[model samples]
Target chain A: MNWLGLVPFAIFSLLFLLLPTFNIVLGAFRTQQGAATLDNVMNLAQPRIAIAFWVSIKLSFASALIGCLLGFILATTVALGGLPRWLRQSTLTFSGVASNFAGVPLSFAFIATLGRVGILTIVIREVFGINLYGLGFNLLSFWGLVLVYLYFQIPLMILIITPALDGLRREWREAAEILGATGFQYWRRVALPILWPPTLGTMALLFANSFGAIATAVALTGSQLSIAPIVLFNQIRGDVLQDPQLGYAIAFGMIVITGITNLIYIVMRVRSERWLK
Target chain B: MKSARLWSYLIFLTGVMYFIIPLIGMFEFSLRKRRGEYSFDAYTSVLTDAQFQQTFLYSLLMALVAIVFGILLVVPTAYWVRLRLPKMRPVVEFVTLLPLVIPPVVIAFGYIRLFNTSSVLPFLGSQFGTDVLLSCGYVVLALPYMYRAVDTGLRAIDILTLTEAAQGLGANWPAIIFRVIFPNVLVAVLSGAFLTFAIVIGEYVISALLDRPAFGPYLVWIGSNKAYEPSALAVMTFAVTWGCMALIQVVTRFSKHTRTSI
Candidate 1:
């Protein structure tokens, strides 16, 4: 076999994926004149940059956790809750569409649903005399963004974790029940252990998915929201703070975080397959 | 047992509401263009606008290019890896997944710097060149989906034996791959292509930063200025996405039926 058959793929990845990322990393540690320096990375310690990172982490963590939990419930309901075959198929198909129904149009959909003059907002006010804005639920805040992010995040969780749920053998459940264990006990003892790896892996995927998202947040919250991706977006586009090199540092940081998350996801996936072996 | 059913029903109902409400709201808001009544004025306006047609057509052309280029790059590589370089499967899969981890903004950022007019490879030297670079970036963004779909398709068929059989019959490598293998996995390639279309159609970050007149940036522009028209555009975008996904379902179903009947 000519192993050289793999050359084109390698070169494409190098030119597109690895090289651009390497440029960011290399640029992160150098001055404009090419001298090696730590100033760009150090700029991350500035309160604003540090807060941007914190806010991003907090948003990703909240959204991923909520998405994972809700998606787990939805998937378990469809896959294991004795739903009909058509329901399962329809759910899967809808999840496929909704998960990809993200970015710019998703923001518009949410705005029409929950914005100040939204249908739900108007209905609540007319029916119960309660203002949604007065309830501190602005769709542009951190909580609001989490609410929007869950629209896709939960569907994504459902799409990924459904198979894992299916991988759960009925024999295990029957065996647990024959041993006089309740349904809850079967899940806690037999099911949760087997599912831990995939569950965690899916959560990490969700985290990275939301962390690197730029368009929906930018469209909904504008560039005013100090999330990491938006901050990075402005920096890359305008060098808004007058330091082009610091932009490289921020992009480098995003790569490191996402890479680490994905690495954990890969490790968990490998570990999850151990049971099958 | 009944309680479990009830719980399941409640959860499913809640999920359906969550998924459907935004779409309903967008549709309803779009119809509110006539003030205190319902009409399709907003849709008509968005459809008739010259800029909308231009940008939508521009993005559609870009989507086609990305899908074609993505297939050209992915199919052969996936086929070769499965047929010859089995040891390189892990490496190839890892490379495919790299695009998911890296944000589009970062990729476009790198392109602006690395392919600017002054750079050795000047992809941004002209407007046409910038469109090519933007489409290339779309290919990267859609790589994860395209590669995975094509790879899964390849795995479904028996490529190794087919290649050997064709080789023994005095067929050359290109003939074996194109004539024999390509037609077999055409369904899988079509599924991936539709998905890439969905992704490239409404993408905002890369095209916005690249200053392309694409549908995504146009949607954002309308959102900032117009009220009801943005909702109309949102509904239209949703319909397009649904169409792509439904086409995927049909293709898969058709492929399965054909396989079973044979």
Candidate 2:
């Protein structure tokens, strides 16, 4: 009976999650001769791969940092005293729905609203002769990916951090105040120390989430972009790479990055749990 | 102080505006006719077309199938973990979070590699084989939220007491499990199901990978090639996601138990 309960989850996980991952890892080393080698893993050091790798890391860090700062402030404000409980809950519900609200349609939305031919683009031109593109900020390039990623990242930040903030005891803040700690002094010495761990973990999770995403990036920037997931997507879809095994190799690269990020999440979660204690 | 408050309000309101403008823009674009006046022509086209109707029906049915799969896979483990396997709760929780940590794109590829070969897996050969595999994959993608909802409901209940009472009545395994346990977790399952419905209805990654013409893939193709109709399709998807969320709100409004997770 116990095995029955475990059986369904195990089978689904194996068929859907584990096997694909297994296929990706094993496919990485198999040569064209059907023999395994180090060629695929070693491909990470190629010049173009190096550029894509650097760009992805930079964009992810910048977006995650901006998202975390904005999310932390937003969470602290409502979770403390900025909004009434009803308002706070309502805002959160909206944010929750919107945060999970990305993918193909989201890319379409951004394009139609902010793209070169977008409505706001025409309006901004007439109003200020400030062509959005003239300003050299292409919403269809590297910055565009960041913009779309931020669409969800900030809300995710708010969602994950708000509940943790709800656990912050007001009495502690009051005690710090009574001890003659000024506002800045109190936050720096008290709140920052208490809040750093969860804030950091949420930041890491958001980075990983954005890092492994493909649809939004692909739809917005075109699949030819060198992002690892986009490359893998193209591979599997019969694009540049003809072999599905090569696609699996690309997928393996993505999994390694995500796996590393998730391991970081685990470590952060444990440290956050202890720090909260 | 007042000016600072105004500044903060401005920032937050700007964020809200940016978020909503695209949804409104899609609908606005969908409504405008060739005469440059608002009309229902786009929607009428979408509605009257046999392919559109078929795709929408397929999507709705697929959503339900995935939701049912979610309940079947997640409900059992969530119950047993909360009741008999208390020690394994953390491990169970960790497994549920796996889909989120590994992005959807990677997982979608994983499915193709694992199940694409007919010779390897006996079931990947036919249409039925692929669709069933797709639903199973959808369940995995939606697992974190669905399982969490059920687990939260379990935390709110005295599951041990419920199971023990059923056992004392000499109810067998299935009877005690279904009759006593499932009743309390029904709302959690419903909430999870609705979420799964939204995800599967709009999901493009897995469906496209599997080469199925599901709703998400339909929307993607329409959006990319045909500009005007894509806006109409976006409006429809927007309505569907919003409707699902609103439906859940209405259901929770009437019920005594409301579980909120962000």
Candidate 3:
């Protein structure tokens, strides 16, 4: 009788979420006539598809690494760096907002700030007499997207890692001090050991977060960049490659990558929670 | 300690600058619609645009539908899982978190492939059907946050006790869920709803692929077509997101205050 309560929810999930995903995963392996084959999956080795996957991975890695470093620094400064209470409070509130402020508007904001004829670009050219374009900085390039991604990625990192930082326990630091440990020695021996798990976990989450991003990339770079999401977007819109199964393969590959990263994140989070507890 | 504090402040200032410069630049750029003078021309244009109005309203309606449907689906399930199916907690959690692992583009692709006009369930056969599919996609995208919020709220209140008391009073399941459990977790539900609104309003991949007139696709369309107006729209979008987060804070604080007063 009680099991009947989950019926509607179960039906909704099965229909909308599970079945669609299962269809995609199933399509990735099947041929046009529905015969199971490895041809589509093997087609992922083509230069176009492979390059898209590689670029996507590199972008995700760069943004996640940089976001983690910067976010950890900012979070540490606020949580343990003797900042005023109000600053910390406001920083957190701002982070909660900024982390969710991704997709198209974020790309728009970045373009207005860094695009050609953008205010900062004009300012730099007028004041410093140096053209950012001449300096080989294009907002549509790889590094440009990383910079834009960092806007939200860093805030997300700060939000996720703050509690773990708070769990660093003042007693442990004081105890290390009383044991004649230097600051560097304390961090190396005590703090870093404890913090590394959550930091790395957050990096994994950040990687997956940016890995799956499409709107910001599409809005900012158009179809100029061959990142996996954009490629998939184009494929879905018009079948640019004229092969729907290869598109499924690409989407399958994305699911696999993000799935692995998120799995790592969950594992690392569990390990860190044990220690934090 | 002195040097450490100074270093912290330096890093903090740098972070602040990195975050603030784009916003300042955007605002400044948005005012550049008129040569040699700052004006709100760009904002006015964006605000008055017909496509913007239509797409914004369409996304807003979709967001509302997603929130209501999400609450209906999630609240009862979360309540029941807590009260009756505690052993299935991990499975429920993993299923909820699947959206985070699977990208929105992939999910949207799956929907296209599975529910196209030729498929058994032709959700994309019409605009209304596609809108339903898009709303369900938003709910899936937001499942992680919504489920976590409701679950955290359930943990705060004693569901077992509430359910037992409601049962002793001869109330049915729907009444207990709606009357007893729902009120207790209203704050959590509202927080989740605001987050959902934030996500659905600016969503791009699902709605874009589905060919829906959503604000996200509209933003992207304008971004490519217009110059300064994109910045003004960006500012507006940022405010909407900020408003959502702010409301979540306000409600959570309000809930705490009422609890303390009680």
The sequence of per-residue lDDT tens digits that candidate 3 reaches over residues B1-262 is 8999999999999999989989888888889899889999998988888999999999999999999999999999999998889888898899999999999999999999999899899989998999999999999989999999999989888889999999999999889999999998999999999999999999999998999989998888888899889999999999999999999998988989435111
> Model 2 Cα displacement at B92 (Å)?
2.4
- Model 3 C-alpha lDDT per residue in residues A167-274, reported as the tens digit of each score: 988899999999999999999999999999999999999999999998999899876789998899899887586889888888999999999999999999998998
All candidates in order of TM-score, best leading: 3, 1, 2
**TM-score of candidate 2 against the unseen true structure:** 0.93
Enumerate residue pairs that collide in model 1. none
Using DockQ as the yardstick, the better of models 1 and 2 is 1
Off by over 4 Å in 2: A1-4, A32-36, A243-245, A275-277, B1-4, B257-262
lDDT per residue for candidate 1 within B5-35, as digits (tens), equals 9899998999899888888888888899897
Per model, state how many residue pairs clash.
0, 0, 0
In order of lDDT, best first, we have 3, 1, 2
Identify the candidate with maximal DockQ: 3
Candidate scoring better on TM-score of 2 and 3: 3
lDDT of 3: 0.91
Query: Alpha-carbon error at B34 in model 1, in Å?
Result: 0.9
Write candidate 2's Cα lDDT for A1-277 as tens digits: 5556677777777777777777667878888677978877777666765576667777777788888998787766666645557868777877767776777777877777777766677778989788888889788788777877787888899988876777677888899999999879988998888778778878888878888776677667656678766666676778674655556566677677767777877787777776565
Q: In model 1 chain B, where is the ten-residue run with the lowest total lDDT?
A: B253-262
Report the candidate with higher lDDT, 1 versus 2. 1
Q: Give all candidates' CA lDDT scores.
A: 0.89, 0.75, 0.91
Worst 10 residues of 2 chain A by lDDT: A241-250
TM-score of each: 0.97, 0.93, 0.98
